[model samples]
Target: MSKDDDTTQYDGAAGGWGSVRGMLSTFREEADSPAVLRTLMRQNKPGGFMCTSCAWTKPAHPHPFEFCENGAKATLWELTSHRCTPDFFAAHTVGELKGWTDHDLERQGRLTHPMRYDAASDRYLPCSWEDAFEEIGAELAALDPRTAVFYASGHASLETAYLYALFARLYGHNNLPDSSNMCHETTSVALKAVIGAPVGTVAPDDFGQCDAIFFFGQNTGSNSPRFLHTLQECARRGVRIVTFNPVREKGLEVFVNPQHPHEMLTGDGTRISCQYHQVTAGGDIAAMLGLCKHLIAEDDRLRADGRPGVLDHGFIAEHTIGFAEFAAMARNTTWEAIEAASGLARAALLDAAGVYMAAERTIGIYGMGLTQHVHGFENVAGFVNLLLLKGNIGRPGAGISPVRGHSNVQGQRTVGITEKPELAPMDKYRELFGFEPPGETGMNTVDACEGILAGRVKAFVGLGGNFLRAIPEQAAMEQAWTALRLTVQIATKLNRSHLINGRVAFLLPCRGRAEEDVQESGPQTVTMEDSLSRIHGSFSTHEPASPHLLSELAIVAGLAKATLPPNPKVRWDDWTADYAAVRDLIEATYPDQFKDFNKRVFTPGGFHRRNTARDRIWKTGSGKAVFTTPTMLSATSIADAPGRYRLITLRSNDQFNTTIYGYSDRLRGIEGRRNVLLINPRDIERAGLADGQVVALESDAGDGTHREVAGLMVTPFDLPDGCLAGYYPELNPLVPLWLHDIHSKTPASKAVPVRIRS
Candidate 1:
């Protein structure tokens, strides 16, 4: 049968639950159960390892098992028993491997040795570490450093990211493209513009004191389950929780803590949200504007009645500027425009605003859903605007929290895995290495993809990440990757990035965070910065899977040493031998934050970094929380013709970011399939479609391309009108590479216009 036919047949015969059961059964067979349990126990413990999954902060207080479901799966995937040896590669040609699914490619398991692709044999052959490093060095040295791009994943520890950045600058390239560019770029850009730092203001303990919590575009339940515990506690304390998202997630509705013996025994779950409003895609800025306007009106009423205003007028005058301009803009925005754009009734917005204004303490939390839009930066600004109005910052139970994905993404940025131009970091490199660092602006993830496609990027070296699968515009990324002269990936397992071969491609096997790394100094511990901007130490207890495998730091240092002549001023070997030295250097570079890094990290629960926003201090040029007036009030409709639906990409409960742990999205009732599109019952009827029908969705922007998914089980859902949802990576092909936030360059992964046909 044809691929389309197979998809249709599978959808009809295998019910969603059946498919889920089958996949779970397979996962059980494939998973290394004992190793998973062992690895999970190590997470967030003193001298234990860090989670390799999302960047959700480990609790200030440690748990017996800090591993969430996705975290456990990540650990298992890393410590899999399967191995991809040279002999296995000999049997499978590169051409044949290219035809395999993403699941199949990763299922080949851990890379056993350093291997280089042989075009003549159409396979990868084993090569010695020294030979591989020499070839990599030779290729890198031949190219102008400006043309080379260095990419990092959030999985890289603080030590590895520091080394990666140092190596790139020493090699005279500032092109440090990172995973953050794709996910939380808007948070970084907007927060930095308003505050001196790019991190959130609140720590985990602040949740306990919050009277109200407002979340925009964040799915805390599936994305970060541990947060549910805090939310539950807040609910029990009569704290109000509100959400604004296109879809109502199960986790947000209610959660039964399996850890709570009483709750689990009774099968009782805590009711989460006091109010849940379905905001339209790209409508966050409008909703926020409406709230600000309502606050102003309420304040006027209070003043007219000889009562104190709802706002912290004293704080605003003392700590901020530009309030007049911001208040004017909010007051001027018409209720009609706000209602139409947000698809929220004025009454609903006012209700939410009233609750926010009445609260003694409020916390604003958000995720990628808010950042992956055209007006993402504006959305963040609006959140800050509300916080500033109420003086809800710097105190317990109040602040902004951007829920970042990945274990060490924040740490990577903390240590300089950024494309943002920094003179101090560059100067430090020059002073330490006795060479001038590149001062030119570097490429971001999007720019890197474009450069490679245009043949401007000669070499691609990824420290650790599935770049091919994670990046949007799959075709362009694939083409660019295949066209490179040399590509080197230092990773623990086989991934799609390794499949896209260049003229000379090398895959270097590396040790995972779960494994011990003993060097001349002793058993070493690496530090990671959590989502709350707290840094903690992690040490591995398990033995390395293979003695041949090198640490990510060792591999990076070897490559740098091979590529550059020995510089006695910089002790590369010393840093590699001892991770503490790396931390010392990090402390030296950023003394304002990491003073006495080793001593501070040793403190129980680690240390919280400086948060200027907590003090309501605006670090913008005008020293105020500037309210930005958007040039466009709403996103331009991509639908030129009728019957077009806005497609929002989503991740399943079984998935974490780009990594697919399993095929089932338990809450959504999707199983053994990432191809199905989720449509509301109303939308299905409006489109003259029935349940379990095959359909094709075509991009409305004249891309002239269509994707077919069959057996879609139409179910009624609380999603916005004219909006549909589907899984990402699979749907990534539809989002154009150039379609992104203008300022932050984050792909518009959440909002894409498309039309469905039966």
Candidate 2:
């Protein structure tokens, strides 16, 4: 077998001995022994810190080691002994540091103290906390608040995110764009309009009861390895598991739970997907429509025979709207169009629908594959429409699950890190803080970039994230990023965003999730909400990497205190000292969701915020769930020219979002390399490209500019014909800023029109 088939040919599973070996390799590289081991043990446990990895739900019951291989890497990556100190900065100028790779910068380790950019020497100089705060405050106070963008990353806790929202609102603008804008914004927009709530209805317990679970564009092995354990259990119970993705990812194939004693001892694994359908890039909406159409046709056939209808007619009539129109649209859709758009035959779609019909309950889980497209909003809505047809929502083991990447991207949105102003509770703010938040809509990630480019947006305050590296159009963004008057990053370590400094930039060092945060009240616990909507407290028993590092809560409060003039309504000092004060404000702002903020979160396993849709209660404008119809076959038109290929950007097994851990992707058998493209053998031959041939990918959006990324090697793999896959951020430059979902404004990273060149 070839190197690409290592996962299937060697171990035949994702998380067997390979996971253990990877964890050990990371620990050795980090060079921290018992301390890192202890930290890993406490991950996702009560009174323990949350994993800095992906936001798969934490189990209600306890485990000795709840973290996965990549989760362990994240924790150790934070706890590394290396530190980026004043001396290190003095050695390297800003220009010199800009040339360093992202992995090299992060490997330099934690930021020890606050540093301010010295333009004269082109180096960062350590600055006193008071001076840094006062200067940042002065800059903010001088600029019009409307022009300043306050961005937050998933690394922040609920308490810190709440403070960030309050500070941004009090500072007089709602330019609170966050990490979600680049990721699951499509899900938030679609689900809220369809079901009245932005979050999913299913909980961790639902996995046990689910008779069938369908995955779309989600690579579970790398993004969320812990989820493989849940799938393993379901597969063992004879539950039907189906997958639809452009790439034949090993995660969706088979898995062996590293924690299972029997599997570990015997070196055996469980099969994951019963039916794996390789849909074309930008073809999820078409595949989703095909499934819906198949079910509708089956229902008509069953009814013609005077038997029970295949679709849940009672559920549709009582709890949903626009069923007749939706059914008509599906019935009108032809199988030829579906096959051409989806790159799947009618037989395959019908076979998948048969699995859906056999199960009493089901869940639809998706990831970036479904969202980062031109019609991402429609893609998500289509998924929901299929579940609604089968009445697979609002009951045990049934619902839609958008498996979020970041640890708390969903939590940040819950606590008000959004561009939409109407989502904020204005009346509640008036009753509690005696100040009205900005009523006008603010900018999202893409909008903020455009604003920066146009000189409309001045300063930027980032809670935690490498915003410059995570977004699309990297080259253009790098040029536009210099327009900012000031940039403040509250983070634990160095990232590419730190290198893209403004005229006045400050890097404020903050404690990591694995480090204990001590405030006036004592060692404090931060709360985070999982993708499943369960709010839980995270405590760190490990010592801080640097004594000078402050908690995110303290840093945000200090920034607010310096920027805004003293106000009796907002207690920045008290909230900084005691985090409970922040929680109290959050409860007041969102009483319905967070009534007992302090008590419930601190309790073991935390409490799940009520999802009204889970109880068959739709809070939409029509007071009922609405069925949506897509007017098109797919997000983007199929590639017409022979050499033209649809591009899909993916994260390697060794990386987490923009953070690259190593060059080796063990599952895919790619070692010591990331700048390579995965293509099908047929496509490679048709394009006249040889295996391991160096090539360039160029994209034309019909604008004068032709975006291109060169020096990428071609590696033929299991990708569908007329489709090519490359690593993200590396290929983000090919994605034009204007090419995005119109509703959510999420960059179309998944389905870019491109042609390969030798």
TM-scores across all candidates?
A: 0.94, 0.98
lDDT of 2 by residue, 401-498 (tens): 99998998999899888889888777777788888778989999999999987889899999998999888778888888877899999888899899
Q: Quick one: best TM-score, which candidate?
A: 2
Model 1 C-alpha lDDT per residue in residues 1-758, reported as the tens digit of each score: 11131121121211123323533454474565566557667777666788787777776577675655666667777777778788889899888887876777777777888999888988889999999999999999999988899999888888889888888888887789888998898888988887656889998889888899999999876688767777888999999998888887767777776566676556567888888999888888889888889998889889999999999888788766678888888888899999988889999999899789889899999998788877678878778888888888667889889999888888898887877666237666665667887677888999988898789998999988888888877876786677788899988877777888889899999999988899889988888888898888888877677878989988988999889878887677999899899998898777888988888775666688877777666677877665565544454335324797777889987777776766766665555677677776667778887756667666665665543334344434446888888887777777777777777888887877777766
Q: What TM-score does candidate 2 get on C-alpha atoms?
A: 0.98
Q: Identify the candidate with maximal lDDT.
A: 2
Error of 2 at 227 (Å): 0.9
Pairs of colliding residues, candidate 1: 54-406, 55-406
The CA lDDT at 296 in model 2 is 90
Question: What is the alpha-carbon lDDT for the whole of candidate 1?
Answer: 0.79
User: Which runs in model 1 stand beyond 4 Å of their true positions?
Assistant: 1-27, 30-36, 635-641, 702-717
Candidate 2: residue 300 lDDT (0-100): 97
